[model samples]
Target: MSAFSRFTPLVSVLPSTVPFVGPEAIERQRGLKVEARIGANENGFGPAPSVLAAMREQAGDIWKYNDPENFDLREALAAHLGVTAANIAIGGGIDELLGQIVRMVIEPKMPVVTSLGGYPTFNFHVAGFGGRLVTVPYVNDREDLSGLLDAVKRESAPLVYFANPDNPMGSWWDADRIVAFARALPETCLLVLDEAYSETGPAGSLPPIEALIGLPNVVRTRTFSKAYGLAGARVGYAISTPGTALAFDKIRNHFGMNRLATAAALAALKDQAYLAEVVGNIHAARERIASIARANQLSPLPSATNFVAIDAGRDGTHARSIVDGLMQHGVFIRMPGVAPLNRCVRVSVGPERDMARFEEALPEVLRLLD
Candidate 1:
């Protein structure tokens, strides 16, 4: 295939790929339908009725661009988090915010630190910007704070990402430990403390807004996509010192936000009761997933987030077979990409119907594999 001749050296050298394959793409490529959409860590309980109503109410205003500054959302988030408006930066989602963060601090070949099998999207952004990745392996299925710190110091890395209630494994460290790790870091090394699963994590898993808010080197990212059930809305925010928060305004696409999505997020925030209810449902579904895994002789790891990672009690190849087998039954699921962590298959919490699909399919898949 022919392509444009005038491209940057980096762009020409980089392979064209996304971090993860979407289920739609899987369906298209494999001629299979995803009946149980429990692969992506999406809140299958869905947004509240009030959120839908708000989006419908805003439908007439879709023709107009969203407020470029995102003033209202930031103010609302600030009030909710007990911070000033200047301390918040709103973006399409945490993914976009991660890219912007990498672009801001990482020059060509600059070292960035993260867990070995951490969030791949962040690694995708780092690679896109020509940043070198310095990885620290997981300790006992959780991100290694000490290992990450050591790598950062040894490499003199400029940026480090640590996701609480982490993805893939759903493990987490306590708030105090996380805060201590943040304080121990060199002020020159910025920390992207990703709390995307904050709403769904255990009580003590997330540090208070006041704990790291004063640190210019710390940027904590959160999203309405999990317990709030607004993954499609693409609403996420970053909390930091006023000076650090303002940097996002320099590079972020000001009008990229969808008007209805913003309306959905605003309404989701207002409905605290609905958020609590959905979180309960998530917890219950997590238990149900664990039960299903255990009944089939698989071990389900304890999760602080909305998904459970079931150890297939074998190597990565065995876990891959389980993931592929489940998909054959119209159940879509995912697993970690590297060794040891990849020994488990990840299943997201969903409504009862989706859960039933997973339950009915898992045992049969395991039986066939046996």
Candidate 2:
């Protein structure tokens, strides 16, 4: 019954936690089936038929390992983004790349800067590496760029994480401001510009590849999980100077990528028309979610991602009650974690069936709360 005593100190002291409790875990813990899974910011509209077909075709090759170089995916992404293949590094997803970045730059007790309530998975990676997190609170529901830069300077932090079309709040700054923020950071600091929701964001919200590609300290991460509807496939990549991008190869899992996932991502990239159509559907669903919130007398904040955050007009407890109540009726959703932000509930865009289930369940949940 005795536990192994040889675990690292950091691992022993860290609390066992997940960035988000998945819907499957919720269903198991609460003994309820999820009728509508609009909580995880997944593209419930699903992947393009072409992507599915490609995956099916490649499934027969599952016994083979994916190319360690990730040649085809990186080359495809480079051509799509107008960059050289040497400027790219592929990973299982943004989450894995974040962990690698943290390990590359952080030593024990070193400072890492990020928004107070930004993507929790980045925070989790920082903690796993024993880095001290220096958080800057959101200003007006958006990640405070000036505040984050100030903290980075004040702490002389070597690593910083920022997300465009940020999670939890679903807020973003235009490309110009993001570029300025990146330029302002000291050359000693490495910036992790997380653009996982890039395809869903508005025009001019993403900086062009030419803007920061030459900066050695800047690494922009993107994923197939959102607009591409490939969350299950676990494909993502980082864009940086060729020198900086190569750093991931020194520490990354050489054969971590799945073969079929690579095929799906390649097919998804080739089908720009499908991406556009899904984006249009996503826009409509955002409006539908906002309308549902307004009909229930709650306010929906403007969102640049696949999800919308609705202000429940009270404290964390009240927002939590609505989240819980909705789940009781088989509609699964989530809420922000920290104070002030926690007054809102976050819902992801899905198909009309999921939206209809949410529309029917929300008013009943709120009525019960009333």
Score every model by TM-score: 0.99, 0.99
Q: Candidate 2: what lDDT?
A: 0.94
lDDT at 232 for candidate 1?
89
Question: Per-residue lDDT tens digits of candidate 1, residues 220-339?
Answer: 999988889898889999999999999998999998999899889889999999999999999999999999999999999999899999999999999999999999999999999998
* Residue-level lDDT tens digits of model 2 in 1-370: 5778989999989898998899999999999999999999899999999999998888999999999999988899999999999999999899999999999999999999998888899999999999999999998899999999999999999999999989989889999999999999999999999999998888999998899998999999999999999999899899999999989999999999999999999999999999999999999999999999999899999999999999999999999999999999899899999988999999999999999999999999898888
lDDT of 2 at 51: 96
Reference-based lDDT, each prediction:
0.94, 0.94
Tell me each candidate's RMSD, in Å, in order. Answer: 0.7, 0.8
